[model samples]
Target chain A: MATPRPSGSGKRPTITEVARRAGVSTGTVSRHLNGGHWVSPDSAKAIARAIRETGYVANSTARRLRTGRSGTVAFVIDEPPASFFEDPTFESLVIEVGQALAARDQSMVLLLAGDEDSAKRAENFLLTSGVDGAVTASAQPQHHLFERIQAAGIPLVNVGSPAGLEDRVAFVAADDREGARMMARHLLERGARRLAVIAGPAHTPGGSLRPEAFADAVRDAGRTGGAGGTGAADGPEGADGSVAEGAAARIVTVRHGDYSERSGEDCAAEILAEHPDVEAIFAANDRMARGAIAALRAAGRAVPEDVLVGGFDDSAGAVAEDPPLTTVRQDFRRIAVELVDALGKQIDGGVRANVVVPVQLVVRDSTSPARP
Target chain B: MATPRPSGSGKRPTITEVARRAGVSTGTVSRHLNGGHWVSPDSAKAIARAIRETGYVANSTARRLRTGRSGTVAFVIDEPPASFFEDPTFESLVIEVGQALAARDQSMVLLLAGDEDSAKRAENFLLTSGVDGAVTASAQPQHHLFERIQAAGIPLVNVGSPAGLEDRVAFVAADDREGARMMARHLLERGARRLAVIAGPAHTPGGSLRPEAFADAVRDAGRTGGAGGTGAADGPEGADGSVAEGAAARIVTVRHGDYSERSGEDCAAEILAEHPDVEAIFAANDRMARGAIAALRAAGRAVPEDVLVGGFDDSAGAVAEDPPLTTVRQDFRRIAVELVDALGKQIDGGVRANVVVPVQLVVRDSTSPARP
Candidate 1:
């Protein structure tokens, strides 16, 4: 952990000292230090010795004044600090972004702006542009940090949907609606004729977008969702598939959780009590899905056997579950690449743009193909 | 995140221009910008307007030149970027450290020096004293990053045992030896004597220190560990406890893992194969402990019913296990506080020193007392 951290001090040796000790002009010392360009070999050696003897570490501020680039980027988390550990989505994005930045020979400075005060501090640092650009993950629209970042005017990339300011700020988002639709279709293909869902908080885009998209797909299959409807098969899906007549899957019930595992468990227990015959369950995020799976196990139901389960965000928890989750995978790697690329382009005078990364459906044991 | 990332422009307005526009000396303009000290009200107003008209954002580098302080600290991770998400200890420390620094109105710059190139970049940063100090976590002895930081000569605080350089750098470490000893004693008190251990990598301090301490404590109980002999108990613990005279525990086998859940499972599986009669297993870290629990369950060896399980590091994974883990808890909050506090002292001309934070054993269902 003892990495050399660049810093500043009051009584540091000046370049004048190095020039004096080397018996060369200050201009020669500056040139030699910058790149040894135009400096004789003997002068370079003397300057090196003088630098070592004077303990003359070049001042970072002075260096920046000459080069005008800090060679760093800040990865800001715009939530309470608790989310940094609690939410696996942030974790995935962080690791990806850090590695990508490192691949470009850049350091990623992680800043937690979970509160207004911390946001102010972050604003102070970012306003100085000590870092080249910023990438914000898990930030909500109209967040104060947003306006502050806009004020700083550095190249910015938002990981999720940026509600507004579409033309002003660059954003990279997963196709949440499309992913949810794919999950719903997969559930139906597994012969799940009755369904339940644990959606995210209503205030979030995922909260509204995913369940709505899922219900829309179910409806497109000639199924009615939200309010329970057991009788049906009038949907178009029976046209080409093996679905029996009037066997269109129905959304028997729906509940909302705060995207936490405990919330998922609570919502699942409620759905089980209210819609006991529900054939399959879907959660907007993997955390809630894992919780739902645990609840089902505790209630004596076997996943993919007695009750099928599916989740979104194929995060770390998705694989850890006993019956690995059949979840939608957000393209975090692509997002990171796009974010860094977008920043580079913006720095190179390119226009700010939006990119919607596709989501993928990964079928695992949690939602096995054959349903009882 | 379209944050206001302060950046330098190719044609940024100069202070001399501002001074000329304000009809004042450049020194007067500087005074007005710094604090408005010794500047008349009219001159101050003119300077402010001129700055706005010029669209000048103060250069961070120039500001640093004036202040001689960056008001930031580096939290160096001496491993690859992958560990940022995989290892919960680092996660916990990051959150705690970031919050602590926020409380002090100082920014924490996260830098990864997992390889030689990244290490070089990190050294370049710290050498300039861009940050006031550095705090490194999860580092090993003789790491190249260490010597680089020393060459930089800024205040530093290593978050674990520094291995060498005791006189040069300050450090704060958890009492790993005492914590391991406590876990061994707890398992014995819970009436299990046939113990097995899943230790960390041999190259790490935790890898060697914890197992040795646990073995020492077992010996204090008059028990032999590592390469088992289960015939009899010649231990003194029977004198004061419920254990029968011949029931002292022995470590049937010991295995190593890379502190990964997968590795933990592998080690536990190997131990289970060689020591089927073992009553308990202890892992050097929480991740490994969680993996061991999973393996034990997979083998139909019920936790605390057929075999008790113990793990070091009461991390997030500890609680997520079905039978929540009983493990050692390192006080990351205290460590963070001490790190920041120590840096403050060092910056204020205080002597470097070491501090060992005590560890505590958190009892939970995994190592429940009525062991079979």
Candidate 2:
């Protein structure tokens, strides 16, 4: 039986050795490993085997010397499959953050923590990967990754509220609940009495707070003196679709989506089925709102005439859509600026807890006055 | 400064000493220097001062041990501002490539090389930064950064065909000319005449080859070929738009764009003004095609009912548009796969050359019979 070689023994195998063993030149070895070019399958397998057998590691030190800064950051997120970059709100935010980090001579290393495996991978990457720091973004409160990040001594700046780990972490977030209230007020000001909501997943902060706040605003505006179970509703009181909030305040129907276009369409179809008389629809995010518009159009409803539509996260597509969408702008760039700033402070040993970035209502043609 | 101390002569300036000098804790010093979190303005200045005074240079060895990979693949593009990620065809391709790299445990470092200043910055980053390799996407051949990247000894891959350096460097590209020719032939077989082209920028290979091959195909079809010139002409041939081979070929009119939506809109508008009787429109890319559709719609023209439209690059938006687009689908993923394979080989000491991925036409609802 062959004895296993002692760890770290002998001269560290050079890249050239692997090249020679694979019957290829050093350039082939470099190109193959770097993944910018291709090698034959036979040679590729041979190269992989040689790398493992010879315990060969590229002189990453020499490589780093050429470049001044280590170019890696933990990109943390917890979302459903295909929903990672598909959600217009998260997509715009991530892209903006990516642009910001790239400008500052940093690279966004994606650490997808959508599941247990991904979370574990993220934790390990955070601890061992040569990332300068981490910019963590999550719709849900991923306490596990947050705690691990803090424990690993990796400077973490959450893109949204850190929830249970708020005291320990630095974060940049939008006032989602406040933005929802603002949207509700706009609809009311426009005299949209028959309101409905297309909410996001209940687990996410954006999904939970936006609908809740909108309901609160509606109830407060009506001043019907608190009906049965009105204050204890899951999302918003009006969203329950029951005369639960009393007949004085037109009850709003609610349907939930996982922040997906298809879900938005399905939810919109359901809402319309239940409440065909609904005059206004406010989706939790822009993608869903866009879907609602499509569904409304499909159902032979004229936007802002028979049915006004609004969404959150003023994504690029929202502005470009047929009628232009009325949505809330989450100020992603500001969040990015604040997160970087907070991370810098935390890195310097100052604890600045939970910071909030402002959001605003952006009304476009998708919304208009309710039918007289 | 009173007595210029020899750098590194005293006790190696540990982070602890720097923190003490800065009047902050070691954790704060770590965060400030690493740029992970925001430090308060005053504390950050103090840490900066301590770092400068101590002449502390974070060694590359420690960094290498932490990050298994060197850093990032510096990504450079020579497109315009809005064209960066707004053009669906190019943007989708870029995103696909980025995703591929991420899957392989690599991070992409963006180097915006749009202007001379940004070009210089890109050159400097590639030369001095910690990127293990660099990838140039849709870059113009004359850019300073493109030249610098070629000279840099690090591993390099060009995403598209870079005109002058094609033979000397490795690249992954789509078969643009072949695809264009295929589309032109398909249109002719469907009995279409009076064709107009919305061409992309002439400086790049994708833009240049597509129109050139398309014209060649029209001439080969034995139609009177008159559409081969760069400037506008009354008729492609002498009197009637006829093929040089007497096969009845005629270049209706050609308009140029920088491959952006606005540029596409302008070009399409110009083409329509020149030839309202045109039966078919072939846009070099999907973005231009979408713009052409919008222009056509605004002019009260019906698609496939009045004018047939064909576009390149089967992007997601292309399929999702009002009328699903008929397009030439460039095999971007296959090119990415090949690029990765080739890069792995080249890194391991293999010779590399230019590679071209195939493209195919996807027939959809956009194209129809010419208005009789």
Candidate 3:
């Protein structure tokens, strides 16, 4: 009778090869890699070395193909790294995006295009990873990868508006500026006199628009001032040095952050230091709003008591905070619903364009009549 | 020369067929699906119906694989339904897990197994989806699908103990009981005389082990009964309705929650109400600890002042809470590290088993000296 075939002999140098090279049993090689099994660190290191030299691919690809799935998607977000996971608003978006992807039998892969290096890595990963399509969220106009993504001609869906990308990429995004304007109008009606705005980074995509929209609403209401009162003239040497002044008091102060929660806290602290009598602080997103509340409390200023705080993005955590936040609610779920629907189209060979969702204001405990 | 291809004579049905059936313009159908293009709400509904009837598959599989990747890995977690996204600890773990998988040239496909139905769906998705491997974080044993995972022999790795699944699966877990015991010892040394333990659900795999470990440590320390008191065989069903003899005074009270922050608050409130002089509370996880702190403060109790508080799982958002948490630190990063390493091994056809990492106590503002 033929001798019992040794395991993995005719095939490639499997675990047995690594075991032999490390001068240990196959079980030892397995345990060393697993970490829970009682194996000496020395033995683990030897096995790792052997495996590296043997050049054995993990071979998950063969199994993956049996299910007929490419197994991944490109989740591209045009934002700073610090702000990616730090902002509750963005975090909620991520959760929703992830959930939507899961529902469609797809995986939502997060790609941070904060800087050039990360962007390059993200683009390379997207192109090579065998993702069916790309989901671009809040991309800036300056993102060089936009062109590359378009050129690759793979199905691409944009989550938010990228400056010039509306012409080429299909996308789904909330009407951000419209939401900001609505918030501004609410604050005005609530009699917010000394308004201070905490905006996101102006150089980035959404940053320039929110403040601009707020200014537009203020102007349309005949309240005087542009999106922000002072432009390039106010503090050209200050953080946002270039401010051309219009109506300064109605739009009293504008401070900028990279849209990170930590930055929100710092910005609030700075704004409070500069304008102690400020009554209403309108943060661009829920994360910044939460930070502002924390700062206000630390400074002994009560929320909606000494000051009425309003934010944008009705993140789930905002409702559970010490005081539930009052802010403009962007329908992220709806946006996601539309986004996936659009992605299905692009991959089905549809032309690229932008899809916009409406935004609304959600009132809660964080804002109130300026304490009589 | 070959006749020029007719403008609309493509192999696949043009956007026109989808639009014609749906009674909408080709542009509307195209925009509704490609993501970025704008479409009227009414048209969107029609297009969805048409696409469904057409049996349209995006064919992302073929197009994406052209670049040589399916780009996905399955992310598996065992959490309760409502607590899935509500619990920051679990949420952060998933994000980190996603990050790790992404780092390894893969994308994470999220699979939530919070209940029986969800678990079945997750198991189906795991098998059917072509994922590279599964990062199973289910803490509930006796899950029928665990056996399925074992039989299928995919690169399955559990984040918690694989209780009855030792032989068939591999896993990466933090030392839960060890961490609990260490915290118990710390509390005892700090002179937390009237101590109480607010544990997680008894049915949960982690919950059962933690309380047992705490009991062991208390016994080892010789701090079971009050210095001169006999074990209580006569109190009204102890605060949590769990029988407690007077002899178990030093480690007296015990209650349980489904492991929610809200439950933490409730447990603290009930225990304090029953035993007003109780000096310390040990919550099973950080979320519960946070709730307890909120409840304590609301009832005029100062954390670590009138009472000391500690928790398990140094989760995200814990350090950032009002008074930073003092708790047992279960290293999720290390867990992720071991998990990826183990998965890489299994994918290489190496038979690996369970791995355990050490747990340590993390001191924060929540715990302090008992009142003088």
Model 2 root-mean-square deviation: 12.5
Q: Give lDDT tens digits, candidate 1, residues B1-372.
A: 222222244444567877888899999976654433477757756765565455443344344545545567888888877766678888788888887887777877778777765665676556543567789876654455666565456678888766555576688888988999999888776666678889887756467888989878877775343212333232332212334445555778889898999998999998999888788888999888889988988998888787888998788756676888999999999988888888777765656778888999999988774422
DockQ of 3: 0.04
lDDT per residue for candidate 1 within A304-327, as digits (tens), equals 777879999889755675888999
Among these predictions, the greatest DockQ belongs to 1
lDDT string, candidate 2, A1-372, tens digits: 011121255444567777888788878766544431456546655665565455442333232333322444546775533465455565666667766665664545444456543444454444333344677776354436665555445668888765555576677789988999888777655545678898987666556778889888877867843322235322222322323333444446878887778888898898888898787898988888888988988999888777778999888765677778888888988887677667656654545656888899998888753332
Q: Per-residue CA lDDT of candidate 3, range A78-99, in tens? A: 6654455555656666667766
lDDT, candidate 1, at B95:
86
- Let me know the TM-score candidate 2 reaches against the reference structure: 0.68
Taken over the whole model, the C-alpha lDDT of each candidate is: 0.72, 0.64, 0.63
Give TM-score values for chain A, per-prediction: 0.76, 0.71, 0.68
Order of quality (TM-score): 1, 2, 3
Second chain of candidate 2: TM-score?
A: 0.74
Better of 1 and 3 by DockQ: 1
Candidates 2 and 3: which is better by lDDT?
2
